[model samples]
Target chain A: MIELIQHLINGFSMGSIYALIALGYTMVFGILQLINFAHGDVYMVGAFTGFYAIHFFKLAEHPSWLSLALTLVVAMIGSGCLGWCIERLAYRPLRKSPRINVLITAVGVSLFLEFAGQLFFGADPKFFPQVLSFEGDWSFNELKINPLQVLIFVVSIFLMLALDWMIYRTRLGRAMRATSFNLEYASLMGIPTDQVISLTFVLGSTLAGAAGVLVGLTYPKIDPLMGVLPGLKAFVAAVLGGIGNVRGAVLGALILGLSEEFLVGYGAPTFRDALAFGLLIMILLFKPTGLLGLKRAEKV
Target chain B: MTPSTKIKLNYQSSILWGIALTLVWISQSAWIGLMNPYYLSIIIYAGINIILAVSLNLVNGFTGQFSMGHAGFMSVGGYFSAYITTHYFAQSLDSLSQIQQALIFLGSLLAGGCAAALVGYCVGLPSLRLKGDYLAIVTLGFGEIIRVVVLNLDSVGGARGLPNIPGLCSFGWVYTWVLICTFVIWRIIRSSYGREFLAVREDEIAAEAMGVNTTQVKVKAFVIGAFFAGVAGGLFAHTLRYLNPQTFDFNRSVEIIIMVVLGGMGSITGSILAAIFLTTLRELLRPLQEWTQIDFRMVIYSLLLILMMLLRPQGLMGTREITSFFRNRRGDPR
Candidate 1:
């Protein structure tokens, strides 16, 4: 029972990070209907930004909540700018082209980011600086929890709640929702769909950046290629949660995280990656619209 | 000239050309034996890539099914055929006559292709119901799952990779398969059934409404494409003399897709040209990498892909054949 609870906690923390990434995927997909393949690399960029910020700010020498907050803010802003740039440069011109063309371009951008990242950052893995070290686990009987994990959970939840509030309560969020619903109609209503799309990318990438930093804090090893698997798994989470639906993305991410944790904890560890894809295939097969996705009839 | 007579004359000439090509291929051992081994290997690799790109174009280009899992099928063929040769014919390979060895290699290649086709059929059956990006994601998932499974299989050397496979594939075998794959796909594209594939690509609902059995046509395209991909994989394994799971990853699939797209999707000759160009370009990048001490090949390739999509989304050939140009010159506009 204690082991199960322990796994659950681990899953929740991991799932939160996935939620952050999935939110980006879901939001971008909602607005543009294009899978921002580079979004994963943006997350990597965010992690690297955080890494540089830590070093530049001497955060490790002066560990505090302020330093951590500063690092997160820098990463988020950097990634958000990157997301905006990618939208303007790579995707905007292809908006009138075929979806396949846009998709291929997105892939190109993704490859460019990954390889360029390797060129710029070097291929070797770097140990993320421990900015806030809580050198022990909180033990409750046989169950134990790391303070970093708690921090990850708390920060992710707080971000998600902020996202929810922004989407539901703000005028920009209303514009974003309207644009996603119908681009032409939204533009007709003077919504500045282009700006809305740009904002969507920015918002999504900011969350992914936050997730990247949180993941670095938890895992401590950051590399250029680190985002590939997690990015894919998070995309799967987005799909599972019913892509384009914010709440669905979060729900789907938590489910994926929980299932993956259980699989790794109990099942063969080698099959962990496969399990995500397998779950994706199964979900796609049984529920094409996803758990919370609405079914839309095809119009000729 | 009457259409029937034109087709007959074309068919007869094609047969003669096939015979001539066969004779040239038969005599290739004499000439290819003397060529620089380095250049020969690149040519062979280019041929294998042509097979991959052309086969992929059949599904992605003509049929408009975005399958990002061609590498998975190729890996299946590679591992399966490599296992057969290593386990079964390792001892008696040298003792066998030349013809007998060739026959065994051919058999194994066929077996590998059949295995991949079967896998493709299984994957395509349920997944084909989905459209566009959904289908792409499912296929990508299946591909990743296959790679993960292959990585876990200890019998196939696990993550260490299966090594020491016989180098039975040659330039002749590769070109022959390339020609065969290209010819077969071309025929399919030109045939009445091929029209169904185009119809589905143009609009699935319209094709279905026309009673075009869209699902069956898609499954067929997938199976055929997988078969050729398998053949290419077998050739790759034999020529490379190794089978690594990493070799057939998503990047490899993207490389093949790039060939199809850059050449113009649905254009067989374009695929062939793009495959050769890209393969040669990659080889050329080796020296540049040595000079710069940076792996700029993928960076350049990605930039090319992006620029191509941005500037020329229709690709080089844009669904038209090289023959169309010649025909137009002859005052017969296709």
Candidate 2:
């Protein structure tokens, strides 16, 4: 029972970060209707940024909330800038081409970033310096929850709530929502569509960066290739939740995470990927749109 | 598009030319005048790739389905051929006259094509519903699944691939199968059925509205493509005298797609050209790897792809055959 609970917590911890990244994928798809394959690589960039930021800030020495806050700001901003540049350079031109061409371009950009990252940064995994993580005592049926895991959960929930507030209440968020709802309507209503798209990328990348930082703090073993699986999982999460729906993606991520852990417990570890793909195929075959996805009815 | 602009390959002369070429292939490669093993392998590789790219061109170029899982189907062919050779055909070949060996070779090629065709049908069923990126994603998933399954199977060398695929295939065998493949594909493409496949690419809704069965056309293209991928896989297994799971992974699929796309989506000759060029280019990159000490061929490859997209989005020859680039240019306005 304790192991099950522990696995559940671990699953939630990983699931929370996946939700953050998946939200970004869902949002971009909502507005553009294009799958940004590079989104996962941006997550990697964010994690690396955080690694550099934490290393430079010496939060290991300062050991305070202020240092932590400062490190996060720098990392998130760096990731946001990286995301912005990638969008401007690679994707902007392909907007006029066929969607498949754009997809191929996305793949090319992804490969370019991954190889470039591999080239500049060597293949060895790096240890992220610990900041606020602390081991906690077992409570409630002997399930121990580390402070880092708890912190991740808390931070993720807080960020999600803040995002909700921004999207539902703020002017920029309103413009974003309007653009996603109907780009033509938003543009005619005086919302800057290009700016909205850029902002969406920025905001999505920033949240993903935040998730990266938290994930690094929890796992700490960072590498250039770390984003590939997580990125793939997040894309799956986005699909499971229904491509354009944010909350659905979050729910999808959590479900995938939990289910994967359960699979690990009861099934062959090698079958983990097979199970995930099976679910994907079945979901796509039956639902097509996803759990929370709505099909847009075309008008003649 | 217009009847007046019909392709001008002289069929009667080409038939005579084909016979002359076959006589040259057989005589130049015969045992009393023995075919060199080195040349045999290259000839076999070319034949296999011709089968693969021509078939893949149907789905990717003609039908406009961006499937990157051609290697998955290829691996399926490999696995099936391995099973048949080891369990069924290997024992029966003890009486091994040249004619008996030839019959077994024929059986394996057909078996490989059948295996690939079946898998292709299953994969194509998804395409009837999904469009564009979704289909690509599914194909990628399918490729990964094939790799993982091959890795886990203990009988077929588990993570290591099944080795010693009973090397009965040879220069004559490969060319014969290649002839069959080429003739079948050529006839299929020129027939009215090929017109339906092209119609799906020109406009799906219009094609569907015109009483054309889009589903059947898609299924047909997919089946043919799978058959070639299978034949290629079989040729690869027999030629290399080994088979491994890694040989038909995601990257392998991407390599095949790059050939079809780089050559010209629907152009059979373009795919053939691409297959040869890519095969040689990769071999050439090996020397560069040792010399440059910067062994990131993928980096160079990625850059090449980006440049291709930027410069020639329609690929090297587009939908036109390589022959068109030269022969059709005569008496042109330019």
Candidate 3:
């Protein structure tokens, strides 16, 4: 029972990170209807940014809540700017082209970023600075909870809630939704669809950036290719939740995280990726629209 | 020309083509027999790539399904063929006659292709339903899953990779398969059934409304593409004499896709040309790695892809074949 509970806690923390990344994927997909293959690399970029920010600012020397928050903010802003630039430079011109063309471009951009990251950061893994460490775990009877896990859970939930409020209550969110619904109609209504699209990228990437830092905090190791597997799993989560549905992305991510944790905990660890990817194939086969996706009749 | 006369001419031309191909094969073999190992290796690689690119064009270009899992099929073929040769036929190679060795190679290659085709058929059944980007993701998932499975299989040396397979692939085999793949794809595309594939590519719903079974066409394209990919994989395994799960990852699939896209998606001749050009370019760029800290080749390749999409998205040949160029030169606008 304790083991199960511990696995649940681990799953929840991991799932929250996935949910954060999935939110970005779902949001960008909602607006552009283009699967940003580079979104995962953006997560890697964010993590890299955080890693640099900590060292540049010498936050590790005096690791505190303030330094950690500062580092995260810098990373988020850096990633947000990168997201906007990628959209403008790589994706904007191909807006009128075929989806496959845009998709290929996305892939190219992803490869470029990954390789570029490897070039710049070196191919080796780095230890993420322990910025959010504590003395001991909070234990209740036989159950234990690490402070880092709590911090990850708390930070991710806060970001998600902030995203929800922004989407539901803000004017920018309204523009984003309108643009996603009908680009032409939204533009005709004087909504700057281009800016809205950029904003969507920025917002999504910021969340992913935060997730990157959080992941680094929990795992404490970062590398150039760290985002590939998690990014893919998050993509599966986004699809499982329904491509454009925010809440569905979160739900799907939690489920994926739980299943992954359980599989590794109980099942053979080698088959973990197979299980996750197999679920993607199964979902695509059975419910092309995804769990929360609304089926629209094909209009003649 | 009268239909009867035209049919007779086509039969004569096909016979002449057969003789021409045989002559070309003999001459090329003799030529390769005297060449240095380096250039021969490049040519062989290019030939295998030609097979891969052309086969992929059948699916992504003509059939209009975005399959990002071509490398997975290729890996399946490679691993399967390598396993079979090493486990079942490794001992017989030294004692066997030339004819027997040739037969074993043929059987293993066929076995490899058939295995890949079976997997392709199963993958296609569920995947062909999804359109555009969704299908791309599913295929990507399948490719990654294959890699992960192959990585975990201890019998195939696991992540360390399988090595010491018999070096069965020769330039002769590669070129022959390349010709066969190209001829088969070309024949299929020019046939009436090929028109159905083009129709599906143009618009799936319209094609379906026009009494074409879109699903069936998709499956057909996928299976044929996969079969050739497997053949290419078998060729790759035997020639390289090493097989790793990582070798057939998504990057490899993207490389194949790049060849197809760069060559001109629906143009067989374009695929051939692009495969040659890109493979040559990669080889030429191999020496530039010392000047840079990173793989500038891929960096340049990715940038070129983005620039190409922005500039000339239809690729080098677009939909026009080499024959079309000749026709245009003769004042026949098509």
lDDT of 2 at A126: 85
Please rank every candidate by TM-score, starting with the best: 1, 3, 2
Candidates sorted on DockQ, descending: 3, 1, 2
Q: For candidate 1, what is the DockQ?
A: 0.76
**Tens-place lDDT digits, model 1, residues A164-200:** 9989889988898888888899899999999889989
Candidate 2 is graded, for docking, as medium
lDDT of 2 by residue, A187-213 (tens): 999999988888898888898888888
Residues forming the 10-long window of minimal summed lDDT in candidate 1 chain A: A291-300
List candidate 2 segments past 4 Å from native. A54-71, A133-141, A297-300, B1-17, B20-24, B27-50, B87-95, B169-182, B291-294, B325-334
Q: How would you encode candidate 3's per-residue C-alpha lDDT over B82-108 as one tens digit per residue?
A: 999988888878899878988888899
RMSD of 3: 2.4
Chain B TM-score of candidate number 2: 0.88
| Fraction of native A-B contacts kept, per candidate | 0.69, 0.46, 0.82
lDDT of 1 at B193: 72
lDDT of 2 by residue, B1-334 (tens): 3344444443643585489558746664666135566555665677677667777888889888888789998988878776777667777667678777766766776798798899889888888888888888888787778888888988888877787678876665556666666666766766677788889888889999998998888888888888878877877777777888888876677677777777877787788888788766666687787885544766766666666776677887788765556654685421
Residue A202's lDDT within candidate 2 is 89
Which candidate achieves the best DockQ against the true structure? 3
Model 3 segments beyond 4 Å from truth?
A296-300, B1-20, B291-293
